[model samples]
Target: MTDIQFDDRVAIVTGAGSGLGRGYALELARRGAKVVVNDLGGSPSGVGASASAAQRVVQEITDAGGEAVASTDSVATRAGGAAIVQTALDTWGKVDVLISNAGFLRNNRFEDLTDEEIDPIVDVHLKGAFYVGQPAYRAMRAGGYGRILFTGSSSGAFGHAWQANYAASKAGMIGLSNAVAIEGSAYGIQSNVLLPNALSRLEEVMTPGYMEIPAFAEALQSTDFSFADGRMTPEFTVPLAVYLVSEACTATQGIYSSNSGRYSRVRLAEAEGWVSPAGTTPPAVEDIGANFEEISELRDFSLPAHNYDEFTIAAKVARARGIHS
Candidate 1:
């Protein structure tokens, strides 16, 4: 396939002050998308805001001969999110792509984590995506075309130590992306989540012993080791993201993991478990316990579109046995 380009599209990239968001903003701008570079300029812990980080990225984009505008808006608030989207509209006249990449991290053991720690993480990572996306989604619905790329994380989809709050926030993004994909389909808007493993501010908090794992180390090292002095850089993952949030991409409701020149899709599905006869009284706990292996078998599974689809499958099984009651 030819390289994807966004010739006349307008794009919004949050958290673009640094790290992965910066790379995405620059790449999209380079591809001819008029970009709204939205960043709160907050620290990795999500404290203290500055405008320079965002403006610096905008400067880099324009200096590289790409079109972009700076937005120092906090995505954690509804008003801030609206301002971020407004920047794109006021400057470019339309919004075609939204990369919900703004996020912050707080690391603590599950038990040690507090509501205070959890709320801000949720605000920046999960709720922030919703705040920014809701307005952008409506605009896209009106325009009849759009693309949304959500920044999920391996910490949530896979697992990570000392990241209970962060994981919950990241995991919530998957649900958000899934719903957006379904709702935006008729409007020509596609939404997908990315579990990106790249070098960024969050990496500093990662336990060093964890990186000793072979898979972890390999995943951390980009093909060009020089990018991060023998580690991965944010740029390695941004290309795939740009394509996923481009008009050229038709994929939606997908979870993708990208790093070190690798890209793969992640699907959430359920097995077709053993079912009890519908007319029969509710099966005893012993019956369910006895059939645990069959129930948990992964040989055949259905990728349900929603909770109703799974129930629909159960309904089909009940009808098939002529046991509906």
Candidate 2:
């Protein structure tokens, strides 16, 4: 087969100053994309800022003969997000791809996580995607084609201790991407989420003593033995992300996870539930308690594409029960 090239594509990768974002920006530029490298150069806890980080990545791309511009705008606010996209339009005339990859972590146990701690994560990870994604979606709708990717995390989907705030923010991103996928489907725009498990700066800058905690240590130890051998680098996760944001990708509304060379699609599935007879009174609590096994069984489940799909499934169940609207 032929290589997937991004020639003539204009991509906006937020948080492109380092780690996974940097890897993606460089790869896209190398493949002929005109990239906007947006990074606020903030610390892992989302405090402070600088422009040197974004400028350095732009320099790297330019040094390698690739086209790119640097934007030091934060992704935490609406104005910042629009400015990042506007930089792309100002420099390249249009945007074809968006990788919402800018994020930082403030890990703490649920009880200890205050508003000051939780708000920034939500602002950067969840709202940041919204701020950047909406304008990019509009541009893609007008341009007739686009690819969008949001950075999600296994912490939220599966659960991880001492990361309540971070996990909640990441989980919200999955919902945002799903909505974007459904709304943009008719306009040639595809949106998906990436749950990346890689060794990046986010981990390096974790709150002091977080890594030394026994639970965190045990969680790391339980992973496959091979994962310790330098296989979980950010570069390993870049190829899948690049593909998801490429024109060749037809997948939308997908949640994918990448870790130590393992790649798979993560889905939210609903089991076919037990339905009561239509001509009788509503089922009692005892009835539900008795049929709990059947109700919770996952043997036959359907993956609903959107909200309407859930309604369709409910309709099918109602029809089977001899009830019609």
Candidate 3:
């Protein structure tokens, strides 16, 4: 395989003060990309802010002979998001890459989640992407080149027992990424999502509860798993994050999951369901029950490329059922 480099590219990494975001910033800088390290410096539950978190990462990059600047702006507000993107444009004149990885956690059961908890998560993870993404997208369109990555989570894509708010927020990242990918296709821009499992302060807080389970505890201690440092440290995810937002990434709307040191693609496919026969009367509840097995089966499916794919697929199904020519 050939080496992947980001020479002369201007990249912005939000939440770069620590964890996976910091790892991405450092590696991108090392590979010749001028980085804008933006971090709100907030606590895990979205509580406070300080400049030190972002500034420290900036110092590390500069000390290593790399170019970077720190932005202590929040990704939760529209103005803050624009400011974060502006930090990059003001210094570099263009934005070639964006890693929208800034977010906070608020875990709770669905019934117990409050508006207060859910609102902040959505503001930072979902709206924040739009805030930063809008400006970066325009710059990319003008420059006619760009790569975008949204940090997603398994808690969102799958489900977690105590992370309803966080999960919902992360799931929105996938939808946002897909929309951007569709519109960006005409503008030399590509967008994708990353669901990474890395050890961070956020994980530190969540892991203890899972360790109480017997099977979970056993897996946690297993040596069969692979990781960048014998554990799910943030470094293991940096390379995959970097690639998704690099010139070398070929697919837009792609979703990748990084766990330990193993990487894999995550896709959303539409299952082909059973169609009522042409000229047949509407099925009653009992008729539907009789065909439930075929309806729920996953033997046939298609990965849609855009919103219109469903209509196209529907037309195909109708023709095959003799409903139309």
Candidate 4:
């Protein structure tokens, strides 16, 4: 395969101080994009901030002969988000790609998850993506060229224990990207979501005791990006990201799962079911049971663009059944 190169593109990557964000920053730099390295430089729990993490990644890129500037901005706030995009404009003129990789993990059972625990994760993971993407999205709409990527997780789309907060936040991103993709199509902006399964500080947050295990220690030192239980190195997830954000990508509103070199798209769909006329009274309990098989049929369906699409489908069903004029 021919090497994918960024050439004159400019990119903004959040949470670039370490882990998956670091890998994305380095890869984008190596591919010839001028990068804005953004990191709150906070701990995995989003407790405090520092500049060291962002600075180190910027240094790594610069030392390796790639162009980059460091910005310490919290994606949770509007002002901070605007400042991050401004950093790219001031340094490189415009933003062509955005990798919303900044995130944290805090795990607790559903009953034990408090407001403090849930709020920050939602703010950082979901709201943060909105904060940064809005300005860059506007810039892209004006320029008529941009790639926006939102980070999602398997936990929410699939399932995981002790991750209710994290899962819900990530799931929101899928809906966000779909809206962006639909609206941005005319302007040459492509928005997509990535559900990454990787090993990083975020993973460490989920399983704190793993580091102290001798077997885990030995495995970490010798592992070569294997997914023997679905554990993947951060490096394993970057190639797909690079492609998605590159100029070659024309696909949008797609959700992909990547890990250990395995990649696949996730589809959200609907099932065709029984329908009734709008003015009809509610059906009796026995009537519902009589139509159970029809309600569960999956032979045909409509993929509604939004919540209101259900109404349109209902109208069509009524017309087909001669219940409506």
TM-score of every prediction relative to native: 0.90, 0.93, 0.91, 0.86
lDDT of 4 by residue, 1-325 (tens): 7789999999999998998899999999999999999999988888899999999999999999999999998999999899999999888788899999898988887788999999999999999999999999988887889999999998879866678899999999999999999999889999999998877886557764434546656766786654446547788899899899988888899999997778999877666677654575988888779898888887877777666887888777768878777
Q: Which ranges of candidate 3 are over 4 A from the true structure?
A: 207-229, 318-324
Candidate of highest TM-score: 2
lDDT by residue for model 2 over 233-299, one digit each (tens)?
8889999999999888899999999988889999989988887766558999999999999889999
Report the Cα RMSD per candidate. Answer: 3.9, 2.4, 2.8, 5.3
Worst 10 residues of 2 by lDDT: 204-213
TM-score of 4: 0.86
Order by lDDT, highest first: 2, 4, 3, 1
Candidate number achieving the greatest lDDT relative to the actual structure: 2
Give the better candidate number (1 or 4) by TM-score.
1
Model 2: lDDT to the true structure: 0.90
The lDDT for every candidate, in the order shown, is 0.87, 0.90, 0.87, 0.88
lDDT of 1 at 113: 85
Off by over 4 Å in 4: 207-231, 277-279, 289-302, 305-325
Q: List model 3 lDDT by residue over 7-45, tens digit each.
A: 999999999999999999999999999999999898987
